[model samples]
Target: MICPFCGAAMEKGCIKGQHEMAWLPDDKRDALFTDAHLQEGAVLLASSSIFKGSVVDAWCCRVCEKLVVEY
Candidate 1:
């Protein structure tokens, strides 16, 4: 996939590490782990670590420097 904002090509790969502040209240972390999003599974990849589970898929956008979590 390409970044819509910068037109940069997205790299395909799996990152692994622990993500601190993933549960920040203002971040609305719980929304990312909803049943609808995690119906399949969860694979989280943050700037520091990757967390694989049944209800969350979190990751940091390297190009945009944003937190992206898809459950």
Candidate 2:
């Protein structure tokens, strides 16, 4: 996808390292989701039974650091 902010192309691939997110007390370890106001947004896609587990990928813009996800 194209980055709307910087007008640069986005790189398509799975995130290299383990990416963790949380909605509880803000800490250095977890990504704060209070701004999103959604609980359980960040989940283990592989073990999740709610949604059909499938190939998941993430894309990021090299210029603006905007990220997009595909599953």
Candidate 3:
């Protein structure tokens, strides 16, 4: 993918996490969330779990040090 920040080429990759992965709002207190109680605007990269990693597709731009992911 092409980076939107610096007009550079981006590398396709995965965002891995031992637990859940998400982009949460700054004002939010805890990262934990259930499917029924998911916060607004929270982009969940991976679901919460134990002993298993979560992998999400992402694009990284080395030039701008930016990462883009889709939920």
Candidate 4:
């Protein structure tokens, strides 16, 4: 995929490290539903599930150093 931010070519790759997302409350989780935005002050619901890390297929733009993940 071509990076919309920089118009640079993207290469398919996998992230090298473990990536995690917090389990947030409904209101906080809704905030992230819009687009690729940052999550702040989010809490993880550890009592519910133990596994929180994930891996995904992604394309990276080396120029901007941004990653686009494909679920």
Note the clash tally of each candidate.
8, 0, 0, 0
lDDT of 4: 0.60
Q: Which ranges of candidate 3 are over 4 A from the true structure?
A: 29-40, 48-52
Return the lDDT, model 4, position 25.
53
Q: Per-residue lDDT tens digits of candidate 4, residues 1-71? A: 89988999999986432345344556667674532124565543222224634444679999999987664
TM-score of each: 0.30, 0.43, 0.74, 0.47
Q: How high is the CA lDDT of each candidate model?
A: 0.43, 0.52, 0.76, 0.60
Cα lDDT tens digits for candidate 2, 1-71: 88777889988886432333222434332544442224444334322223443345778897888877653
lDDT of 1: 0.43
Better of 1 and 2 by lDDT: 2
Give, for candidate 1, the lowest lDDT window spanning 10 residues: 36-45
- On the 0 to 100 scale, the lDDT of residue 1 in model 1 is 60
Cα lDDT, model 4, residue 46: 20
Q: Local error of candidate 4 at 52, Å?
A: 15
* Best of the two (2, 4) by TM-score: 4
Instruction: Quote the positional error of residue 62 for candidate 2 in Å.
Output: 1.2
Name the top lDDT candidate.
3
| Cα-based lDDT at residue 56, candidate 3 | 84
Please, what's the RMSD in Å of model 2?
Answer: 7.1
Give the clashing residue pairs of candidate 4, or none. Answer: none
Between prediction 2 and prediction 3, which has the larger TM-score? Answer: 3
- Considering only N, C-alpha and C atoms within 3 Å, which residue pairs clash in candidate 1? 16-50, 17-49, 17-50, 18-49, 37-71, 38-71, 44-58, 45-58
